[model samples]
Target chain A: MKKTKHKILDMLLKHPDIHLSGQKICDVLGCSRTAVWKHIKELESEGFKIEAIQKKGYRLLSTPNELSEARILVGLKTKELGQHLIYFDSIGSTQKETQHLAEDGAPHGTLVITSHQMTGRGRLGRTWSMPKGKGIAMSLILRPKLSINRIPQLTLIAAVAVYKAITEVTGIQTDIKWPNDILVMGKKIVGILTEMQTEGTNVKAVIIGMGMNINANKNDFPEEIRHVATSLKTLTGKEHDMSLIVQTILFYFEELYLRYLEEGFSVIKWMWESHAVSIGKRINARLFNGKVLTGLAKGIDEEGALLLEDDQGSIHKIYSADIEIE
Target chain B: MKKTKHKILDMLLKHPDIHLSGQKICDVLGCSRTAVWKHIKELESEGFKIEAIQKKGYRLLSTPNELSEARILVGLKTKELGQHLIYFDSIGSTQKETQHLAEDGAPHGTLVITSHQMTGRGRLGRTWSMPKGKGIAMSLILRPKLSINRIPQLTLIAAVAVYKAITEVTGIQTDIKWPNDILVMGKKIVGILTEMQTEGTNVKAVIIGMGMNINANKNDFPEEIRHVATSLKTLTGKEHDMSLIVQTILFYFEELYLRYLEEGFSVIKWMWESHAVSIGKRINARLFNGKVLTGLAKGIDEEGALLLEDDQGSIHKIYSADIEIE
Candidate 1:
């Protein structure tokens, strides 16, 4: 049902300058003229401004702030990433849906995205909550031909990609926290979660989930996290176009991802460290086993582990921990 | 259908010396006496010997040399490893099925075993072939509280468990190969493949697959692998009970796995080194990137990576490689 609508919309959105006739839409979509008319009416009902003429056909005048495959695909210039996008109005977790898709042989660069996440999740079993139509909740499926040890590098790559996208889209400065948190004004604005499915040392699939607080007000966050969470609208004092932001992020992510595949993590590592907030700073890391160590953050190693120099002047590799800047 | 048969067989196998009445079986299984009699006839046709006394009920006389859930569970002594067992006569791959089960929330220590594997696989995209009904193909699911870097040690632990089980069952000495193979008299006898599912640094589940050649004749193997592969029947002069071997392996695996959880991989590392075939010998290791190096095998490190001392006396850690004894 929605597939035909999306196809018709794609034709209309691609050539917004010229009107696409109903006959042409039917011919391209292999449907009846009545079906095309019905789809155009439905698109209009969904806040799409479509101008329909007697014989000139349909012209896409404007699109709603809503996310659609047609809207995203029209502006997305990636070769493969975002080429196959699955959009939802609301979903439990894009990560879970993308994992299932990857297991069922979803291609590399397949993206699952939603406007709202009811059961959003973060690293270490944390819950992520966002208001409806106020953020970008997405999971990208990657099938890289790499070993399990090198998978942690992808999370850092995602951090760099999102950092570039955020800075480019809004011209706002942001810092990438050690593992996978993007901060604005010392408050988190985005979170990235990386999950992997592997067979022995061979990697089968990796799901990179990103949840951002884009247009939400500061009060939109839960009371407990209000002090620590900030959104783009709050930082910029205005609401940014969500579709434009999503498209810009996908563009930069595809660029960095392809570069990482051809070369290695060296370039991405440099980018990540340059945008990192904790590098060369005094910090306290709460390890996964409930142990805390205060050290000077010396940056990341080749394997993506945090290199921490303690008071005793010995460097320690920190794998998974929560960092606090001192 | 098989579940009812397994339950009835479990009741009979648990008390082999006592006769179970038809009414008692019907009452316990929540079925009619006709159903019970039908299941008993089916079991009998499947090679289970039962003596029907006109007045005293049905008595089990003996069992066949076959693999069944009840047959293995009756003699199995484990806390939770084999407490939940899924048995099959033939399957594509036990590893695949066990991975699905683990994803669907199959508990830790869940075991998926089959009599044959049509599409068995080894490390680095290698195919493992075995004769029907003449080998042990099983996958165990484990949910541990460890990071992904420490997962390679589970492969070594599985090797040690299988080593102890084979030595205790057949009194046939075997040597542990570097990563996950068992060699008897310089011939490959067992292959273990350890796979993991993880979210960032948290471990979700690890599936350890063991495929062993038990009772196949030398000719049962394909022409390509016959020179490199050997069965228990070829090593010893007779066929071994597949059920007994399964029970013994599960027993030792549960013990060692629990110990690994409480303590670290240190104990398993020492045990593995004691039985390793390449520990103190000169060996050629073909690395993953098509490089070969000749070095002295100087045991394993705490993380289960093979340590090799080169001719220049520098010790190199071998993560994943094909080792050949020189």
Candidate 2:
């Protein structure tokens, strides 16, 4: 369907700031010049500005900030991650679609990205708001050969990778709140929800859903979470390019995932500790069973479990819990 | 589709030795007498011998030992398990279909059963053969509010439940092989593969696939597994009714599952220890990573984790491994 347009766009992106002849594109893509013109017009309608000179062919001026499949695949320099991506103008949830795809044996690194999520989900089955064209609602399918017990480490690794991408791309100092939350200026800017399909101890596939408030303004957040949630636009007062941010995240994710596979979680653990905001801070963790324990957040252990030291000098390994800082 | 036939068969089984008039059967099922007669003919075609008395109506003389939905549901006594059963004459894999059903919000205890599986899967992605009309290939859907770490306990619990069902129904002595295999006379009789869909620590659904060689003969198994696998028919020199076995397994599963929910895994642990064949014996555990460790298998802990004492007296918590007694 849109694959031909993506192929043409890929050619233009490969040689950025240079004019590409329609005849050359038609020859390479094995399509007629009229087909190339139609695809270019379609791309233009989807927010891509293609500059056409009198006889100098066409040039790509700028790509829209929308997380389109063609835009995300422009310069996606990954071996497997984000290799086969599914883009939606609006969807209920990328997580739901990715789960189906994973069940159908979609290859590793298959990604589902949507411009708007009508029903976004957060950790612990919480509702997350993703305004249209304001945030990145994406889910990545990963098939890691790891035991079920070591799955928590993946959340930490993903948090670290996303944090690094945010800092490198937007130059924003984002901190990770243990497990899977990225915060900026003491407010949450990103939320990650990880789901898995397992056969006993063998993990078949892991779907990591990440919702980041990329171009959202302060008013975009709901009334209740407005005080506690923030976005990249609100923090920087500028609209960031989502395609660039998505590319950066995918790049970092592939690198970190490969490194984690080769060297294990030690490196990821170290990196996660460097950006963690709750370490050495007094906090109250409300566990899944509705029990709250006040403790000092003493950093994560080798398996990426939070080591919380209570007042009685006893340390508890918190697996899944909501934390509140004091 | 087959609901009407199943309903008619249910009525016939309810009044086993009594002759029910066609008008009465039609009135009870809200169908015409012609429809009732057609359904009886269909049931007869499926290997049921219904003696037609001149004016007294129809009497059930005998029933073929087929694992049909109506036969399995005839005397099913359970709160939740097997309340909804999907029967298939033959299928590629019951687990695959059950996973799809579970993803589509199939309720707890929904059962997917097939008379044969063209490509049955064993633990660790091994192949399991199930000949047509010779064994029971079924998958049960469960949505338990348990953590991912405790999922291994469910596999152990299922093994115990199935072992009890096999012993009670067939009066055959079977021993539980560590995680999910039933052995009789040192030959495998049943295999259980438990899979889960989870989000962080919350379990969405657990699909337990159990393939038991109920009425298979010696030649029904493949050449490779023929020596290692034995069926009830091969052991007892007589065919066993699969519907009775299926009903018994579901009944025991519901009882044990409810008990597990109310009392935790202690009772299941004790029962599993009582039937375990490897405990207190020297065994070789082949882990997923291709590591073979020979150790003395102690009884399971409260969480149903195998305690394997190595040569150094160091105990290793065996989460998932294929055990072979020495």
- Mind giving the per-residue lDDT tens digits that candidate 2 earns over A1-326? 33788899988777777799999999998999999999999989988988998678889888887666788786688988888888888999898889888977898999999869999888766788976888999999999988777777888888988998888888988999988899988998899998999998789999999999989888888889998888899989998888888888999989998999899888888889988999999999998788999999999987777899999999999877899889
Model 2 per-residue lDDT tens digits across residues B261-324: 8999888888889989999999999987899988999988876778999999999988878889
Off by over 4 Å in 2: A1-7, A24-35, A185-187, A217-230, A234-237, A262-267, A311-313, B1-11, B23-42, B307-316
Model 1 Cα displacement at A110 (Å)?
2.9
What is model 1's DockQ versus the real complex?
Answer: 0.43
| Model 2, total clashes | 0
TM-score per model (chain B): 0.92, 0.95
State how far residue B122 of model 2 sits from its true place (Å): 1.7
CAPRI tier for the interface of model 2: medium
Task: Compute the interface RMSD for each candidate structure.
Answer: 2.2, 1.8
Give the lowest summed-lDDT range of ten residues in model 1 chain B: B66-75
Interface RMSD of 2: 1.8
